[model samples]
Target chain A: MLKVENINMSYGDLQVLWDVSFEVNEGEIVVLVGANGAGKSSILKTISGLQKVSSGKIKFDNDDLTIIDPAEIIKKGVVHVPEARRLFNEMTVEENLIMGSLHGEAKEKRNETIKKCYDLFPRLKERQKQAAGTLSGGEQQMVAVARGLMSLPKLLMLDEPSLGLAPVLVQDIFDIIKGIRQQGITVLLVEQNVQTTLKFCDRAYVLENGKITLEGTGKDLLNNEHVREAYLGI
Target chain B: MDLFLQSLVSGLLIGGLYAIIGIGMTLIMGVLKIINLAHGQILMVAMYITWVLWHTWGLDPYLSIFITIPLVFVFAEGLSKYLLHPLIEKDSILPENQVLMTVGIGMVLVELARSIFTSDYRSIQTSYTDKSLYIGNISLSLPLVIAFIIAIILTVGLFYLLAKTDLGRSIRATAQDKFSATLMGISAAKITILTYGLGSALDAAAGSLLLPVYYLYPDVGPLFTVKAFVITILGGLGSTVGAIAGGLVLGIAETFGATYISSGYRDATGLVIFLIVLVFFPGGLKRFTKV
Candidate 1:
């Protein structure tokens, strides 16, 4: 489980995230939906230890995350699949996956993990020898996902995986996220595609202007007028 | 015919040394995007280090590689961490600004070498000097041959390291995208320092090898540095293998230019090729690897 309490993030004098709080139970998919600049990505970044929170605490299990280094935070089973699919463009799809598995697990398990990733995204296996930069948008997204899986994180935090992806591919990506949860990895997803996200997530939060506007069960949020009007376009 | 052939052989032999040094220049530039103007000065410093190791400790210049390369690597790392690293870290240091920094560093190094070592030409003569083996009508000097062999080995070895190993992969990644490398848990600060150190160490190796072949002087690096610049730009900025080929081409051009044209301005011929490449082919020659 993960806990974020009263986290405040800022850039110079501009506050990005103000007193934001959220949580994820073990093996559950919790999504944060927001428009651009709503601080959905910022939340993921703060939890991943990339951004310095001005105040408050981020907890993984029972341990305080502020003191841990980003690399060590990842090793402690919190892997972040960054937005824009920042793959090692010059490297093969396989090599990029290997790099993700750099810090955690044994060599043998790493291989097994690669095979599992390949099973999940067979396109990556087919293009194992190809450079990641050349992959199609959907395939590149798969590599990015499969790469994050290499670390075998207890909680996988994905930042805008569906960005720039087509609507059909967006469904496929969300289905993959469902499969990842089935594999027993808890996910904290940030998404702009609100309708699909609510359908897939068990619980959800709508972030508005760096503040949590509402929180409820997936079904409740789907039927809520503000959520329906603002996000779902009902 | 003998004159042409003689220059050709000697050209190939010395070309190896240029390739070795050029690879270092290219490597550092590729990662840091800093044109190391003082690159030649580092070679001069290495030459001085080799000379000191030879005179004080009574070690052969060739045998002193173990001490020279590592020391240079450490020195280069420390130098970047303290001096150049700060400027590079600021993110304002572009390729053009880096050229200035390198030149500034080179001036300091050259002046330092000038003050301590003096400008007097120094050479370490061994029993093998002038000892050349003759096969058919061709004559091969031992030291020149050794320089070629060492250059080839180091160039090939570095290319392999950069292209094959995980650390090398990390370096390449840092070279292309610093932020993305960090996302993968690779440290840019650490990589830059190591890359600077590795590049400086290569300069040390070349300086030590060339110490006997050429006289060691504070200002000696400028000539070779110019040659290195031409070689790197002509071959390709980021390609190690390109540097090697560029070195060989420059070497052959200089030798043949000296033979067919004029020996005094052999460097001019190399410069001319540089200008042509600049005018027509801006990318130089990229040794692109298939992933």
Candidate 2:
């Protein structure tokens, strides 16, 4: 489980996140839906220790994550697949995965975990020797997710995994997310594909202008009046 | 034809030593994204250490390498950790404050060596220092041939470490994307320290290898610093394979210039090739290898 309470973040004088608060229960796929510049990515970056927060606390399983080093946060089983996939462009697909398990227990079980990742994305296995940058958008997304899995995360945070993928590829990525949930890892996803993400998530929150505007069960939020009007356009 | 053959063979031999020096600069540049201006100064310090062991303890230059390399590694790691890494966090007006800081460090190191050694030209005199091997009309300098073999062994070892180790993967990952590497649980700070240290150790090898033939003076550091940078640019910045090629190209060019053109223009040869590479193959040899 993860808890982010009343967190405020800023870049120099420009504040981005204001009093943002959220939680994810164990094994739940929690989705944070927002428009561009709604601070969804900022929230994830803060939790992952990539960005400093002005106020409030981020706790994963009752341990304070805000003050720790980013690498230490990853050791606490919080693996973040950041925006744009951020794969090591020159590295082979397999080397990128190997990097995911660079420290601690994950390193000891790296071979087994890599085998599991290849099973989840067989296409990656076929292209393991190829440079990650050379892969298609869909395959690169798979590599990103599989790389996150290599860390054996307790809470996996993904930012815009389906951002630039085709509609058919987007569906496949969501299916993989569902498969990941079935494997019992809690996922906190920030996505722009609101309708599909809402349909897939267990609980969802709509973030606007750096604050949560609405929270409900996935089906309820999908059918909500303002959600349907502004996001779904129905 | 004989002169050309002789120069070519001699150039290749000396190029092996230059490759070691270039590899050190390339590794540091790759991981830290800064030109360590103090690089040749660090090599200067290592040479002094080698000289001290030789002068006082009567140890061979080759025998002193095992001691000097690790000593320089620790020294460089401390410099990176306590000096360079701290500058990264401090807010500064100049984006190249780290690079500027290396220039200051180099000055301090050169001054320190000067105060102790007094800028006198010193060379190690071993039993094989002036020995040579002959094949028909061409001859190979014994010290250079030995240094070349050692350089090849060290280079192969370095490539193995980079390609086949956990620490190496973390280092490459950090070089590629510092943020993603940290997210994967790699301590970027630690990797930077290790990389600086490793780079310094390679410089140690180069310093020791060159001592038997090259003269050592406090002012020698700037000359080598320029040579290392030229090789880095000529090979393409941060590419190990490119550094090797750059080293050979520079070595051959300098030898041929001395033999065929004019001895006074030997040092200018590397500069001329560096300019050509800058204009034509801006990415260095990495563009060709695509590595």
Candidate 3:
């Protein structure tokens, strides 16, 4: 239920996203696979209102996402779990989760929502009192995801949730994403782990040099020769 | 030994007030990541407000905190939201433009106070102004003891707010990661303004408390601004707990210096300790406490 139309984004004079457009229907796990500097992160950033597009529009379930504040975008039920997990390192894990649901309905259901998050990642419940920075990378990722869920969003956009995790932990994170989808929450994931992400994602887009070069079902792209050679390295 | 005990007691008492001021600066510094050159100026204005309340209505300096806090909070909020926040949005060549703007704000505040108050040193006399409480060899100023008790209450209250309240969590979160805070629907701009207002409110409380025990003028803010930053650095940048310790350390050092060494070297004593702390404990007391 999200549409990004012909968005051109830049940093100063250097343009990073040129006429990039994509869509994710409700309840789907959409993945954007690209190499470093391919503008995958930039697209997510623009959608979340962290960076504004110079041209074109972003419409989310009929709301004009382009013209609103970033905080307002979250209120519209679109939450972004940014790259690097970005947990408030100094704050306790529970405190970090509390930060995620600071407005409206999410805030009202804060205690209940936190209980749900802890149930999703019981390990976080165990380390609830510990500072977020002290957690393992896997645990920190869980906090980041759990924190995102705390927002009670219709759509959760995650950027590189498995970036620094161990191989085993990476699979676990992928499984968590699937579990999230099963809970009726839509996910838009940006990842460099093409083979793994492609296997699980409902649909996938191939971004190269600020452009969406290809889009298809996950299985379609996995079997495509260009995708195998360029991304999966198969 | 009696003299030493006396200075130590008095130093600890005064340090409580200093901690309040430092805590305010630390909150602003932690969230906005600016030096806040106008911090002491805000306190100065609060003192003047307190002075006016006393001079006009004969309100006790202690009772004036309620009025001064909300007044300074709104004024400081406007300063941060209108003056500093906009500068951050602009594409300035120097990233320090926001900081420079605070310096300008401080100048304006000082000038405004000068125009109105005319640089005159003003002090208030209450029933307890000259009274002291004697504990055998040590005598404590009554006003200072009351300020100290109030300072303790306020510090505890602030700690509770930061540790338990949602607004405090948003503040700490924004201080830690502004982008992430926004993604979580915590408006960093509003948080910044709130933090500035909260910080100034604490400063106002300190100013009101200090009125019965100290003299104030338009130029009084610069000295306290230096002290606030020194306390901020001493306590460790952005650590509320550290600010308290930093303020106490400074208060004790200055008092001891005045007692043992030449009284003229009291301010210099705090500077010496500040430099030493910068060199040895660059992380401030946070390095030790990890708070």
Residue B63 local lDDT, model 2: 79
Worst-scoring 10-residue span by lDDT in model 1 chain A: A99-108
Task: Give one digit per residue, the lDDT tens place, for model 3 in B53-131.
Answer: 9999999999899999999999999998899999878997999998899899889989999999998899999999999
- Give lDDT tens digits, candidate 2, residues B153-260: 999999999889988888888898998898888889999989999998999999988899889999888888998998898888988999999899889989998898
Q: Candidate 1: where is the Cα deviation over 4 Å?
A: A106-108, B1-6, B88-100, B287-291
Q: Write the per-residue lDDT of candidate 2 for residues A117-211, one digit (tens) a residue.
A: 99999999999999999999889989999999999999999999998999999999999999999999999999999999999899999999998
**Maximum-lDDT candidate:** 3
Where in model 3 is the C-alpha error above 4 Å? Answer: none
How far residue B123's Cα lies from its native spot in candidate 1, in Å, is: 1.8
Candidate 1 lDDT = 0.85
Pairs in clash, predicted candidate 1: none
Instruction: Indicate the residue-level lDDT of B30 in model 1.
Output: 79
> Considering DockQ, which of the candidate structures 1 and 2 is the better prediction for this target?
2
Report residue B57 deviation for candidate 2 (angstroms): 0.8
* Stronger candidate by TM-score (2 vs 3): 2
TM-score of chain B of each: 0.92, 0.98, 0.98
Q: What lDDT score belongs to each candidate, Candidate 1 first?
A: 0.85, 0.92, 0.93
